[model samples]
Target: MKIQFLNQEHETKFQELRLGMAEYYRNNKEYLSVVYIMAGNEELHRKMNRYFNTKEGMFSSDDMFNEEDFSSGNRILAKLAVHLFNDNETVSPLDIISALDDEWFQLALNAIHFRRYGISSGYDFPEEKLYM
Candidate 1:
């Protein structure tokens, strides 16, 4: 969605999410290729390449979301981002809403809501309302 995530930590986290999704598709090449077309800033594309090219093997979710690794958390975020970005009806806020559906985004949203409004998982606003 229309998140600025001005802070580097948040940005890095977002990137990690994207890399995670890309890695999944990378592993499922034949199936994923025909589905969604990935597009974003140059950095996002680069991260996707890195995750795709990463060596194949068994890795834990902790390892997948690590800043050092292409992380499952990151992949989760990426998958959400891709889904929102590809949706013709999605807009900026809707994109953020879509991203928040991811585990990483949920964590961020829960923290922010708890700190600012004392809410967790917050309100489940519809994507349609977000667009307006």
Candidate 2:
């Protein structure tokens, strides 16, 4: 995603949010496969962060997902898919990732990483179509 930040402060907040998510997944290895799509805008990130960082509430409640729940991955992936796709059709990260054979997966990963580091190159796809 393009992930345009209104200002440098928002971009810094997003970086912080990403770091926190990385740590969470690192600590909870079971959820490592849960795919999270970066937001395309700062307002979305702000809203998502509230749920992700809060101690309790609808999104942050303990009942949201348990490690034992096999469907946890689906739930998380669905949430991300909705945000990224914003289509009436439902899609899952696993579905997309599994469809990516080794070559495509590596290409996508490279593109994502390049964007993450704010790097640009001739091979880079447009931000809007990065995932596709």
Candidate 3:
């Protein structure tokens, strides 16, 4: 399931992530050589390897999505960005619906991301539909 963030910074703040990421990489070039994020939790740390073809960086889960989907507009990327750019922002929500399921992880992840951005779920769990 999709979620509607109070501020919905995924669209606007993504630029922040892109800029911060660029700055981060520029400032610390060693991360390109080694940075570890669990599984798909931080795919970019993984993708950065493939995109650059570093000696030790050989796998990129980005293949899960096509090359064209590199932008942050993708829901997954948006979530990643929200968490990545988090700088002491806490975004709340208007309503949360679950069809009465106990799948709180989705809500937690969403809330956690929002907590980062000061703003913003998942399935009961399956296809998500977000409304503005």
Taking all chains together, each candidate's TM-score versus the true structure is 0.24, 0.27, 0.20
Alpha-carbon local distance difference test for all models: 0.35, 0.36, 0.31
Best by lDDT: 2
**How many angstroms is residue 74 displaced in model 2 relative to the true structure, after the best TM-score fit?**
19
Evaluate residue 102 in candidate 1 and report its C-alpha lDDT on the 0 to 100 scale. Answer: 51
Return the clash pairs for model 2, or none. none
- Residue 34 alpha-carbon offset, candidate 2, angstroms: 8.5
Worst lDDT 10-window in candidate 3: 31-40
Q: Write the per-residue lDDT of candidate 3 for residues 1-132, one digit (tens) a residue.
A: 133322333323332332334432422222211221111224443444344333332333344334524333223333332333332222233222322122323433454444333311111312443523
Judge candidate 2 at residue 126 and give its lDDT: 39
How do all the candidates rank in terms of TM-score, highest first?
Answer: 2, 1, 3
The lDDT ranking, best first, is 2, 1, 3
Q: Across residues 7-121, which tens digit of lDDT does each residue of candidate 2 receive?
A: 4553455445444554433322112111222233333343344444322212442333332232433344334433332232354557548754553344334334433444222
Candidate 1 lDDT, 9-84, residue by residue in tens = 5445434543555454432422122111122223334454443332342222233234433344445434443333
**Candidate 3: regions farther than 4 A off:** 1-38, 41-67, 70-74, 77-79, 86-132
User: Which candidate should be chosen as best, given TM-score against the real structure?
Assistant: 2
Report model 2's TM-score to 2 decimal places: 0.27
